[model samples]
Target: MTNINNIQSISQILDSQSTKKSKSSGPAQGFESLLNSVLEKTQESEQGIQATELGEIPAMDFDIQTVSSIVTDKTDKLLTSLESYAYKLDDGNITLKEIEPMLEELNADAASLLEETLSLGEDDQSLIDIARSTAVTAKTEYLKFQRGDYL
Candidate 1:
């Protein structure tokens, strides 16, 4: 499954188990436990592939280069979209229809990147904030355009 699906599954499980959200460490511990389970499942699936003569394909694991690529690619695209939006605003010749699609794309990409970046072992709060804030700004602008505020 994709990283987005994996994150959604983890989020759902964490939500269901968060009866006491004030416990602070509960969520962190739960996340670690859930991640461990996923890794174990991946290992089991890999073993099955080996039994079938696939030569034990490597299982998925968090890789910094992979995460960095995802973050950089997504954020760069979002930045491009933002620049386009600014130009459109300045020209006063662009329509909501023209920019909505790009903003929506940025929103989707940023969300996925944020989730994957968070899965990294080292907590990079600045990257996390950038992803989150950019996504939020994109959504806000999209909604504003939809509401005719940008017309």
Candidate 2:
């Protein structure tokens, strides 16, 4: 009876030890391999980024002369239209209703011209100033006309 009890106790100790070894080694080995693979992928991506950084970037060529001309042309048109409108207002035959849409259009053009002026060179400043003043004058005349001050 004593020998049988001792054999059973020894068997239990062996079973517990084997279970502990499996629990410790199985997932740890798998996790270590996963971490190593992730590090390798990161290193590959870093090398690819460094290669791109060493490559030459292409230059962009553009001309502002055409753009400046367009702005100038638009500004000229705005000034012409405003001058014509001022003459029409002075003639006093056109009504506020008739002038509304035309004034609105001129105002829109003036605003666009003003925005374009910001991108223009220093030499075009006088043209910008003229457009600005013309717009303001037109607006003032329109207000006066609305208030019956012209009559």
Tell me, by TM-score, which candidate is best.
1
For model 1, the local distance difference test gives 0.72
Q: Candidates' TM-scores?
A: 0.48, 0.46
lDDT of 2 by residue, 1-151 (tens): 9999999999999999988886786778799889998787768767774445435799899765765687778777877887888777667678767777777778678678777777777877776677667666666665665687755
Candidate 2 clashing pairs, residues 3+ apart or interchain: none
Off by over 4 Å in 1: 1-64
Clashes of each: 0, 0
lDDT at 79 for candidate 2? 74
Per-residue alpha-carbon lDDT of candidate 1 for residues 52-146, written as tens digits (9 for 90 to 100): 44245788997556675677677778878887777877776676677677767766766676676676555666776777787778777777766
